[model samples]
Target: MQEATADTFIVRIGAVSAGTIAEDGEYPGLWGAWDQDGQFMGRHASREGVAAFLASCFIVDEQDWS
Candidate 1:
């Protein structure tokens, strides 16, 4: 876990960037989520939720490449 900027939280799996979580300006209190490719995932109530979502997405994507 690292701060992408002052406002954004970055989650990495090993050395790869998994996704990012930031305050959802439109939803207030919720966190906006985006995949590594910058695709919108959804909004989460907490950073932990966002991280779990990104990790699960990465796992599924990795399996698709196999």
Candidate 2:
């Protein structure tokens, strides 16, 4: 992950862009999520909330892999 600005970040998965998380411009203290293609995902009350959302979207489940 890289800090794009004071209120925005570029999330990555080993150099590949996963998505972005940024603060809501209209609502202070809220954050928004977007895909790498720049599609608006959703908004959250906290940065951690948005981050977890991005993780759930990008991270693949590997429990079946022995």
Candidate 3:
């Protein structure tokens, strides 16, 4: 949906659900990201990777947790 990233996004480094985490990935936990509109953008193998990737073209509003 137009890659909506004009707003802040959340970068979480943990398992959101069961049986979806990769034990062999670079990051043990599941690195997932969602846009400001609560839409899941993507998942990565590393926290830094996901953060950097999302931050590249979008603004990460760490303060807007709600």
Candidate 3 residue-wise lDDT, 1-66, digit = tens = 122244323433242211111222334565665554655566777756666665543533433657
TM-score of 3: 0.43
Runs in model 3 deviating more than 4 A are 1-28, 59-66
TM-score leaderboard ranking: 1, 2, 3
TM-score per model over all chains: 0.86, 0.75, 0.43
Worst 10 residues of 1 by lDDT: 57-66
Give per-residue lDDT, candidate 1, residue 18. 83
Lowest summed lDDT across 10 adjacent residues in model 2 is found at 57-66
Best by TM-score: 1
Q: How displaced is residue 12 in candidate 1, in Å?
A: 0.4
Residues 13-45, candidate 1: write the lDDT tens digits: 888888888989999898887888999988789
Reference-based lDDT, residue 55, model 1: 77
Taken over the whole model, the C-alpha lDDT of each candidate is 0.85, 0.81, 0.45
